[model samples]
Target chain A: MLEAPAVAALTILILALFVGVEVISKVPPLLHTPLMSGSNAISGITVVGAILAAGSEHDAVAQWLGFAAVVFATVNVVGGFLVTNRMLAMFKKNPKSDA
Target chain B: MSSTDLIQFSYLVAAVLFILGLRNLSSPKTAALGNQMAAVGMLIAIVATLMVQGVVDYTLIVAGIVVGGLIGGVTALRIKMTDMPQMVALLNGFGGAASVLVAGAEVSSRITAGDVPTGIIPGAIVASVLIGGVTLTGSLIAFAKLQELMRGAPIQYPAQQYINALLALGTVAACFFLGMAPLDPQLFGLLVGLALLLGILLVIPIGGADMPVVIALLNSYSGLAACATGFVLDNSALVISGSLVGASGLILTKIMCDAMNRSLANVLFGAFGAVDASAAAGGEGVDQGTATAYTPIDAAVIFSNARSVIVVPGYGMAVAQAQHAVRELTDTLADNGIEVNFAIHPVAGRMPGHMNVLLAEADVPYERLVEMDEINPQFPETDVALVLGANDVVNPAAREDESSPIYGMPVLEVDRAQHVFVIKRSMNPGFAGIQNPLFFKDNTMMIFGDAKKVVIELNDAVKNY
Candidate 1:
């Protein structure tokens, strides 16, 4: 829809799909929770859409919807990252760190 | 470079950071840094998108970010690790809901001004709304079940499947109608409504036992919805990152299903209340078994004398917050020259790697924990199999009982060990609802109590041994 050709966008989409699957094939089972939560944070990139939605001056209704979208997307982004960090923080190896 | 080029370059940079972050996340040592890298990528993408043309007012945008960030940050920092599955589910739901709002705003604004595109935009909007709506509600239901705010068992009524089928058909029909009359908010609203209902109906039939798969699948759905929204907006960043989430999430879901030896269809539609059904039917054989019981003192003597012990922890261990106690018990055994190892079932706790985190929190050495496949063969040579608050994963039925609902699934071969001590609160069946015949076996002894208390008592007893 923008200046980028549809074919190029689709190309990115297709290649990303393949790389996504390949990157996660060997994640150790111990890190599965962090992996899921970490990838979850990546999906929070939808905050991009939320920012555009909120800033667009379509109409009062559209503005309100956009505002709400920004809020939810922000929560998804901020919360997902913080929670993932907390989980991964526990995965450290410590012979003397155990309580 | 022009602003457009800058935006595109920033997106490219973000995508590269995301890829690097994902690569680093594969190992335990680098995961935290990987998460930080992805966060920085998201920040760059957001800041760059803020510079895009359509954005007008900074007040509402700033307000939304502050309020939402405060809530999300506080909750994430405050929640117990044990409640993480539900937190993740809720976050996934918020992502889906964000997509629905963005897509809805985009389409409704366009339709309000007769700005309909003659291309795939309409279809993209519909897909975004549909998937986003479904993901939002489905994740909410998942969160509720995990939080115990709703029943964790499958909730089915007569003709539930038929009703779900009708809802799916109606939602699709509404989408087609909206495609023709994009100006009609009523039709779009109906599409969203039906999709939301379908989401609830879809997840409610699945029990808590299958939540890991459900959570991962819903996470994937959120990504797909965002990807569709990206197409509607022609935003390359969303499309790329969303596809990454959708693809990796699907793989994780498959891993969860495979770990449990169940297919995706079985997880989604198996409606595993058959155990409850037979129980309600009041079959005598199902209710007739009793397990041999032991005390903490008795377990202490057995554990102290054993040369090697393998501890298996499960959902009950999490509930009892006994990971620390289990660690102490292990330490006591170690002092007595016992080699202690932990066997972790893939779906051990409410979520994937749940027990691992809990064990790690108690400072149990990571090297001492072993996966199901790797630890299965070691059980036979182990002097004792200590099951603390674990159930179905250790059930011999998966290996021996052909008629059991969990018959074909792979389980820990704890029965192979020379002596099996099951520390539980009672003889209740686990989440799977089927009785564990291992409890009544000749070598298995049940020590009944709160897992944390029992483990502590055992630790004390062993200390004095």
Candidate 2:
């Protein structure tokens, strides 16, 4: 089912996969949880696809499904970012009261 | 360039920002900026997708954003640092469920229009539905376990492995059939049901302690499902970001396994939740029947006079919500001219990064919180190891007792310290359900009480000096 353009896309996918591993390799174990949460938040980019699916002209069943998808994906994206920020905020170099 | 060309360019830019965001997030210095970068990338992606031609139904989209944004914002603000893991699990599950719904909707709509996905479209649809279903249910079970709504121990029965294998195979077969017959909603629905069940079965047998790895793996699964959704929709941004998440999550999962000194196969198939018979039996310290106890004053005196102290925290600390009190103890010790550091095991809390987040929430300095490898050597020269509700991570059995199930797992070596003070409710074995010889060591003294109260007492006692 993949055409020539898809072959190019697959190549990009393979390369991106390696880049992902390389970037995460240096993360200190201290930040492993935040990294997981942060990366998990990034995966919320699916909100884009959710929007497209929801906006498309389709049957009622499909429309409702699309609407639900939009809601779920948005929550992932928004919640993920805000939560990651909150965690990282606590990781300041010095305790606020101590300094 | 035309408007369409401009929209595609924005997507390309968003993808690049995401990569940059991930890169920046690897270290502590730039993590916050990294998160913002990713968020901005997401915002751009959303706007660019909205700008696509033939888009409509602004009312439904607006309502979704408002409601979802409200839910996400409110929950993120209200959730305590201790509950972060479950929150992440729920969000990951939401991402998975969205992919399933979107793909299902798209397929059903195509069928309604008398159109069938030929070639790779059908395959992508099948992949999305199958993986998304698994992630959705699997994450929910993880959340339930972390939230203490259900037993955190692994749940298994006879022929469990066989049942899971059969379910996996059946789910795959259903996916293949759906791929071949995209017009058949019944086949598609059957595949979804099987995949969801497979997810529940897959996660139910994992012990609570191993949740970080499970959560990471499921995060990757969600990413793969999103990638499949990207393929179904022919969206480049989705494909790129999805593959990025899938690869990164897999690597993090491997790291979690290494930290615990166990293989992924062992975590999944080892039935770690089942209490070990041998661990339950009597041994050198186990035969003693009870650990030696000490008063809060003695612990305070020992900590105050110590040249260096290392606080090793575990799941019990989180359960007792003692991080704030522990921080107070650290402060009292520091005011007395003693150096203090926190040693965190990789799998220390119910979830990954649990201890660190808790400590950070308590305003613990980032520099003072040390990793296992970095702090192991320090234990020998240390004067006191203040163990707050931590167990198996400090157990000598992981290193000294080869017959032990946790043998060969890297531990915090707190036993090497001149004196050890353990603050626990009782002589209960740790999450692995194993007796720790460290609790019965000659120099080790157990303080019987809740971690929060004991730490507070220790802090007050130190103040008296």
Candidate 3:
């Protein structure tokens, strides 16, 4: 069983998650597109978690799970970056027009 | 490196990266960098997880990596700009599905082990099963709607809301029962199925106009599922990241709803903006009057003689990539001593700020872009309002009739202008899937062609004038 401090820490973390979600929910539409693209970056944290899990010493099953997590995380990271690039590319000023 | 310490450190780093990435996502210029930073964080977490677990079989891992990479790369390279929204929807659905799968797998593994704590196991199983099921079904429906495979409007029946309410109640009762016996895989699966059905039923009635909001809401649902799974697995990083996504997604959804001046209930159940038979029939009392459609020269003549011109751009302009041409025309008109400006409706394109981004790309000065409120009063004084690739935003019916789906929604009031030159592909209505009555109005002249081509033609016409 986890100690009181560990439980408290977990509780605090969970509460923080709720708070973060609330903050995001209140943002206006004008900010949503940018916010989504921005949040895509934040979603990258899963990659970090996956990487750390993979790198740590673990049993075979744990190792395989960690590896799978890494693979998924990488896909998310790369795919998100590519999409964001494409989206931003739309904003590139047409070179032909000077005015 | 102890497993517990390694996991804690990995989660800490992941949390920090998530926080930073979210902060960076707040602005456009730094959004990409924020994404990169988060990716790096995710990479770190994955590596740490692997290290802690100590897996020797690289074959399966490598194969999975190769296949996933190929698919993702090809998708990125092949998809067109127009299909970006659909692609986003698909990706979001996949994320939701993944979380659900993960939760399901975890629950199954726990149950098979037969060593799970009776009290905690049931809650974990129920949370994972229910959340995952809802996320999967909801996201798939959202994807189908966005892809246009399913009708984009609310498919309504009498007492539909009441039926949905009953389904919700039933789902809740089923979830409670499943929680009482989490080790029963059959019951867990049943609960999941029910939740999935509920999600589909919830989203099916929403109209296409509210798709952005629905997509955002589904995204939130997916995040919540992931967060719930995190609780089941006791993963701090997952909880933090999932909650962040869920929260941000909900916020975006709300913003989209507000932009459309809709409520969450209306978006889910109100059948808002559904184009029924009445909407398709066009205006009832107003007699359809035929007007002499003006040519570029005829419109240019009016504009040349006029004191002010306001340009209203919509999704058509973005589709045509006519912003540059439009910009040139505006500049040419300004040079001719004609005061030119732009009128931008809040929901003018596929996504928020779409018109602004497109116009800005053409190097249109920020000052020239006018919001609907600021420019509506000026429309009466304005000699001409050139509507490019826009139909619904400038529709007078939005304000004229109470029965209309879009009625009471603020419009450009372009009909009030002395002359309205509308450049469009055809007489088709907008994404709202309704016919625009403004096309048949007396003051409006349809310049039928590609918006980009028409704008260039207008530029030439104005220059000659």
Best by TM-score: 2
Clashing residue pairs in candidate 1 (N, C-alpha, C atoms within 3 angstroms):
none
Which structure is stronger by lDDT: 2 or 3?
Answer: 2
**Model 2, stretches more than 4 Å misplaced?**
A93-99, B282-290
Docking class for candidate 3: acceptable
For model 1, how does the per-residue alpha-carbon lDDT over B1-465 read when each residue is reduced to its tens digit? 899999999998998899888888878888888889999999999999899877877777888899889988999899887788898899889988999898878876786677875466677788888999999999999999998999898888899878888888888799998767765788878888888888899999998888888988988988888898888888899999999899977987887898788899989988875457655354336644667888888877777678999999988898888888888888878878899999999888877778888887777877888998899999989989999888888988888867777887888999999999999998778777878888988899899999999989888888887
TM-score-based ranking, best first? Answer: 2, 1, 3
Q: Comparing candidate 2 with candidate 3, which one achieves the higher TM-score?
A: 2
**Mind listing the fnat for each candidate?**
0.73, 0.70, 0.24
Over A17-94, each residue of candidate 1 has an lDDT whose tens digit, in order, gives 998888877678888777777777788888888888778776767777888988888888888889889878777756
* Candidate 2 structure lDDT: 0.85
Off by over 4 Å in 3: A1-31, A37-75, A89-99, B1-3, B54-58, B117-125, B156-170, B278-282, B287-292, B302-311, B317-344, B353-384, B412-419, B428-443, B449-453, B456-465
lDDT of 1: 0.85
Restricted to chain B, the TM-score per model reads 0.96, 0.97, 0.82
* Per-residue lDDT of candidate 2, residues B1-465 (tens digit): 988888778889988998898888767778889889988998998998898875676667778888888898899889988888899899889889988998888887888899877657888898888889999999999999999899999998999989888888888788778989976989988988998998899899998888988998998888888888888877788888888889877887887898788999999888884876654764544465457899999887777678899999998898889999988889888888899999988888876678988988888888888988889999999999989888888889899988888899888999999999999999877667877888878889999999999988889998996
The total of clashing pairs for model 2 equals 0
